[model samples]
Target chain A: MARIIQCVPNFSEGRNKEIIEKIVEEVRIMEEVKLLDYSMDKDHNRTVVTFIGEPEKVILAAFNACKVASELIDMKNHTGEHPRMGATDVIPIIPISDVTMDECVQLSKELGERIGKELNIPVFLYEKSAQTSLRENLADVRRGQYEGMAEKLKDEMWKPDFGPANLNERAGVTAVGARMPLVAFNVNLGTDDINVAKNIAKGVRASSGGFKYCKALGIEIKERNIVQVSMNMVDYTKTPLYRVFDVIEREAKRYGVNVVGSEVVGLLPMAALIDVADYYLRLESFDHSQILEKRMFE
Target chain B: MARIIQCVPNFSEGRNKEIIEKIVEEVRIMEEVKLLDYSMDKDHNRTVVTFIGEPEKVILAAFNACKVASELIDMKNHTGEHPRMGATDVIPIIPISDVTMDECVQLSKELGERIGKELNIPVFLYEKSAQTSLRENLADVRRGQYEGMAEKLKDEMWKPDFGPANLNERAGVTAVGARMPLVAFNVNLGTDDINVAKNIAKGVRASSGGFKYCKALGIEIKERNIVQVSMNMVDYTKTPLYRVFDVIEREAKRYGVNVVGSEVVGLLPMAALIDVADYYLRLESFDHSQILEKRMFE
Candidate 1:
């Protein structure tokens, strides 16, 4: 079986169509890699490129795309609504199929080494690929962003895992790591009770002793007159979708609130959805191997 | 997005490894084609080769593999535990990604015509690609198998959708069609009573007024001392997995039987599983677009 891996790199230049096209063109040139999508957020001033292929091909494509982004983007003059630390802010490698997390961690390390050696940019490993406990959280590693990196790098604890200890004025620093597929799911409540939404979010997030893998926040969409329980499912396999949604439903019911609808922000593995179906359908024991498409992989 | 299609061709010479390898070798050479799996059942004397790729590439691979099978195998001497119709028994074209059933129907028809013209073998189009309503069911079309084909070909209704009106003694006849992804799912019952399994099958299959797209039968696995409810899910989208399994569970309760477990026999589209998950999880209006992997395609 071919080991398929996915790499999604976030570059700090989303407003320029010409630059985005050029960066994406590098990935398009690779015959083996399938470029899935690329989008830029003007307000955030960031561009995210999504692609999947064999592990080696994906890594090579990421390296090439990053190189192009570094050349065109100048972090010294970069400003955005979102936090940033580099021209190519963060590059995450996700294992899609027939590949393990450990392998992804190893791939991240290899890419980080190459970026440091070739581009002279600082590289920090986060999540599963982190070298130290402090660097495991991306937000922690990118605490000061680019502006504070010069003084921050002086501390031994803040030293990057790869590249020079000093900062690059043009490219800044990049965080590369491997992590489980995260599901950005949001549920809208029927009522405009922002407090109800906030309480539900607090009751269902990891920080508040809720579902272990869930990180949630409540946001009020003023125009829609609805409150949203926005969430990031970090480890779907462990908590699964059914469990999370059921808990949220139960919590909302206590507040006399009804869930109007839900949304998934991105792509999900087939297995995650099957598990939800199995539980809801009350299937005694359902294995995904029974699905016809899975047989094609056999 | 690339239009992905899958073709599974069942060929008649499973007992001979050399012939099976040579037949599959044709598809293996295609650069875009991914040969998912090939398994030979010695008792049935048949081999099922599963592969997927770009629509045109899959069609080409299927044509080449069938050509190889026709040259090496003679239907006159073929014997198997399972039903046989020709050197290549059945070739079903299934829509995988960014493709529609109508498009697959057109592709199947074109491919069937080419096989008839090029291979000089009678080709019957069944299921979605069938020209006539009577020919939609494969079993009805292949009533007598290879042994009965020569006589059956004489009738107007039995005339193939492609190739000559007469049968070829060597290759016999081939069944070609376009259809939805068929999931071979089986649920084992806790009891040894085959009647219970049969009753449950009747309650969950289309033939017996169950799910509209479900076809089910009861089989006894004597060695395991368990009765099985074997099912072919013709349209997972119309009749999702959770709905069908729930119906079976409800019906099984009437017979005082419990479903021991369920097994998925082959590859399944990720969407099918996701629907089940969404339903059970009560994730109102869940969309696969939220999956990170899917974002690559967008």
Candidate 2:
């Protein structure tokens, strides 16, 4: 089976329809890569594009899109609610199937180099592709945004991983990295009691010393008359959805509440759900080859 | 999304490798169709080929393979342990994704008619595509093996659904139909007592007033020193695997036996596993669109 990877890139100038279309066209024209989704946030002034394919094709699509962004988007005139650093702000390569983090890391570096050398956009390899611990966190690497990027790059520790050590006036700088696929999962409580949901969230979140890869919070669904423990499952392969769900159920029971239902906010890899079934059904010696649809690739 | 369907066809003269290859090559040559598997049993003197693709492509592949079988396989000279009726013995069309049973039934009829008129092979539309209640069961349609089929066709009740009432001299006759995808699932018991497994199998089988789409039996696994309730879940959309699993787990507790684990013996539709996860997790408002890989079709 071919290794599949997903690339989600955020680019500046989402408010300009013509410019966003021009950048997105690069990815759309690639027959080998599927453009899963692309949405422009007017407030944030950024367009997030999601696409997946074989590793090589996905990287090519990301590179082509970034090149278009560099030529079309001028970060010097960019302003939005969200922080910015370049025309193509950030590109994160996520392993979807038959792929590993190390492979994704290498892919990110290759993409970064192409965008930097060919497109002339300075690239910072953050997250799993980071060369230094400080740069591992995207927030730290993107701290100064576009305005402060030129001055920050002058510092010896803040040198760009690829391209010129200085920033580009028009395209600014790009953050390219590898990361685990994130799943937005929310479990609802039977009752409207906010406290029950809050406690459950605290018990399953990493910040509160719960599941190491979970980031969770309590939220109210006023229309449904229920409270939910919403979570960002950063690494389901390590901290599976079923484990967190079982914990939340037990935690909610203490508050005299039952789990109403759970929701997966957006698209998630099939492996994430397969893990849940494997745990609950006690499926033994099951593998991807046993999935009838997986035979399509062959 | 394209409507995908699976076709499994069995043919006579499995002992001849050249003949089997000629038949399978027709399907393998179809660029749009994927041949999932094909195996020949020397003892049974039969070969079963599995393939899937969009409805039209799958039907075309099946036709091409059957055409090759009709030309090369002489059923008069065939002898097999397994029951036989024609060179291309049987063709079962199964809905896999973005498809309904009604659509599959129609596709089977279309394929059957083509085989009858174009190949001059008498066709019996059994199972879901059966024109009469008596023909609904494949066993009834194939009551007489190839040797007895010519005499059986003389009866008005056994008249072919398509083609001349008389069987083709070389090809004999074929049974083409639509049916639900079958999943082979088995639940293992902790104890070695075979009776415990037998009782659980009886409680969850359709014949014993259990789930409507399930067929089950008990068997002892000598290697594991355990007994198992093996089942054929005929229609998971109606009789879900999780419900049958939960029932077996509960039933085992009465005999002081615990469910050690369960196994899915062969390839199963992804929806079967997805439904299991949805039920166990109490997932709400989930749809196939939320599955990342499903987006590939779009």
Candidate 3:
């Protein structure tokens, strides 16, 4: 079985269309990689590029994109509403199929070493690839952003995981790690009762001690006169969308609100939907491998 | 988007492994066609081969397999528990994605014409591709099986939609048509009472005035000491597995029987599972195209 992995690399410069296209083109031209999506947010001044393929090919595509970003984007003059870290802000590698986080963590470290050694840029390992518990969270690793990174790295506890301890002013710092894919899903209610949405969100999100992998919020869709319980299911395998949606539907009944519908905001691993089918259809001995398209890939 | 269609061709003579492999290999080597599954039932003396690809490629592959089966399997020596009418008993073309039943019917007719013209094999169109309402059902088309087919063909009302009016003795007659993918699913009950299973089966099957596309029967599993409602969800799109299961769950409750479990036997189109997810999750604007594996093909 091939080691399929997904790489979503965030770059700091989103305002420049040419630069974003150039970086994205690197992934598109890779022989085995499929360029799933790439979006630029002018407000955040950041671009997110998503692609997937075999581990070697995916890592190659990710490295090429990082190289392009380092050449074109200068963090010294970069400005964005989102967190700032590197020209290639953060590259997170996720295991899609026939691969594990342990393999991804090893891949991430090797990728970090290559970027640090070859590109001569500082790199930090966060999430599953973190060397210490303190560096496990991305926010903690990117605490001071690009400006304070030079001073922050001078401290013993904050030493760079790979590459030079001193910051590379032009390329800035990059954080690479292994993590599970996240699903951005939202369920909309018929009524505009924001309290109903907020209450349901409170019951399902991790902050309030709900599903460990769930992060939810209440948002108003003003034009539609409806409220939505938007969520980020960090690990769908652990917290399936159907389970959470059913809970929200039952909870909405409590507030006299009916769940009208829901949306899967972006591309999701096929296994997530397969799990939903198994739950709803009460399928026995069902496997994702049984899907025809999946068999074609094999 | 790719015009994906599934072809399931049933052939006579399942006892010979070499002949079955030879026939199945015709579909295997076709460009762009995926040989999903092929199984032989010695008791039925039949080999059912399943494959999928674009409409044109699929038809071509089906033609090649039919030609091979016609050469290898002699209907004169064929014997099975299942009904049979030809060397290639039946060829069903089903729309999987970005294709319609109308398009599949057209493909079936075109393929039928070619097979009858080139292979010199008699062809009858049934189901969606049938020329008359009387020939709409496959059982109606294969009324007398192989032995009685020759005499039946002489009747004016029983003329085949394509091919010669007389049957070919060695090659026999074939029924080809366009139909939706069928899912052989079964729901088991905890109790051993056969009556409960039969009543629930009647409440949910098409013959009993339930779902229009579902055909079901209650069968006993002696070893397990349980009864099951086995079903053929012929058109999963029109009457999905989840809806039928829910009805069965409710009906089972009335009899104080719980739906212990369910099983999806054989290959089912990926859309069937996607529909289950859409219904259970109450997704808004959810499309099967959103699946990552589907996009890879596109």
- Which of the numbered candidates is closest to the native, going by highest lDDT? 2
Which ten residues in a row are the worst by lDDT in model 2 chain A? A289-298
Most TM-score-accurate candidate? 2
Better of 1 and 2 by TM-score: 2
Chain A only: TM-score of every candidate?
0.86, 0.97, 0.92
Tens-digit per-residue lDDT, B170-235, candidate 1: 998999999999877788787899999898898888887888999999999899899989999989
- The docking quality of candidate 2, as DockQ, is 0.77
Residue B290 miss distance in model 2 (angstroms): 0.5
Docking class of 1: acceptable
Query: What DockQ class does candidate 2 belong to?
Result: medium
Against the unseen true structure, what C-alpha lDDT does each candidate score?
A: 0.85, 0.91, 0.89
| Fnat per predicted structure, each in turn | 0.59, 0.82, 0.75
lDDT of 3 by residue, B42-73 (tens): 99999899888878999999999999998998
| Model 2 whole-model lDDT (C-alpha atoms) | 0.91
For each candidate in turn, the interface RMSD (Å) is 3.9, 1.4, 2.2
By DockQ, the best candidate is 2
